[model samples]
Target: MFCASLADVFDNSVDLAWRADLWALVRDTPHLDWLVLTKRIGNVSAMLPADWGCGYGNVWLGISVVSQDEADRDIPKLLCLPAAVRWLSLEPLLGSVSLQSATGPFGETLDWAVVGGESGPHARPMKAEWVHDLRAQCGTLAIAFFFKQWGGHENGK
Candidate 1:
């Protein structure tokens, strides 16, 4: 399940009570694996549930990274946290990102990487080479790579 697809679950503006309620719902639904993607990776440590000692077994935590700068800044933060699965959502990819140097605690690498281009009337162009490069990097690292789309189109490349 993609939790809070249109909203940031870790957004500072969201009410704490509402977040608690969402956590409760997550706890109740043990059979479903929740994929929580957030741009505010920094807020996660403080907002997680009390029982999130090593993260929930059913939760796959991910962060949305658009450029190399954001990747450098946020990926490390996400890596520091404990999650059943750590992944990246490179949607609306505006720049090239090389994950060759990104390593997590205990020499861990990202479990998954979803790559896609911007889509919409004013969607920016995504270079095919960029996608190819990322795919190759993920392959070399043995991380699961999912090519979601090429810019200006809905179908995967």
Candidate 2:
């Protein structure tokens, strides 16, 4: 959904797939602040309002990067946007992923990177090395990096 309505609360467990159904409504709404972008593999900006350039309060743009392969494809696309704040939703992190060599025109627009492990009955184990890699990258790039959790029995603190 777009950042013009506060109707949606993000819950990874939700099975709803991303689409253009909520685009028009967000464009018409003025009280929206956050936009949570998620999907298998597609362009989220393509469904947004053409006039929704950027500089809106709390208007965040994020995309799910499940693996290194998806990261290669999604992060670049997300970076190309003109959103006020851009972020990565690395949930259900299945394997090691890094953007060290994926530089491009859009890479410079990145503002935040969130790293987290899968939760629930099928929770997967996350290696500390992977988290460290992201932390190092974010530090080097001056981007915000947040560790959501460690999943399983490991405390993320």
Top candidate, metric TM-score: 1
lDDT digits (tens) for residues 26-124 of candidate 2: 555657656665653254544555566663445677777878989987777666666777777777677788776434484455678888887788677
Task: Output the TM-score of candidate 2.
Answer: 0.72
Tens-digit lDDT track for model 1 on 13-74?
Answer: 99999999999999999999999999999999999999999999999999999999999999
- Local distance difference test scores for all models: 0.90, 0.66
**Candidate number with greatest lDDT:** 1
- Cα-based RMSD of the predictions, in order? 1.9, 5.4
TM-score versus the correct structure, for each prediction: 0.94, 0.72
For model 2, what is the error of residue 29's alpha carbon versus the real structure, in angstroms, after optimal superposition?
Answer: 7.8
Report the Cα lDDT for candidate 1: 0.90
TM-score of 1: 0.94
Error in Å for residue 145 of model 2: 0.9
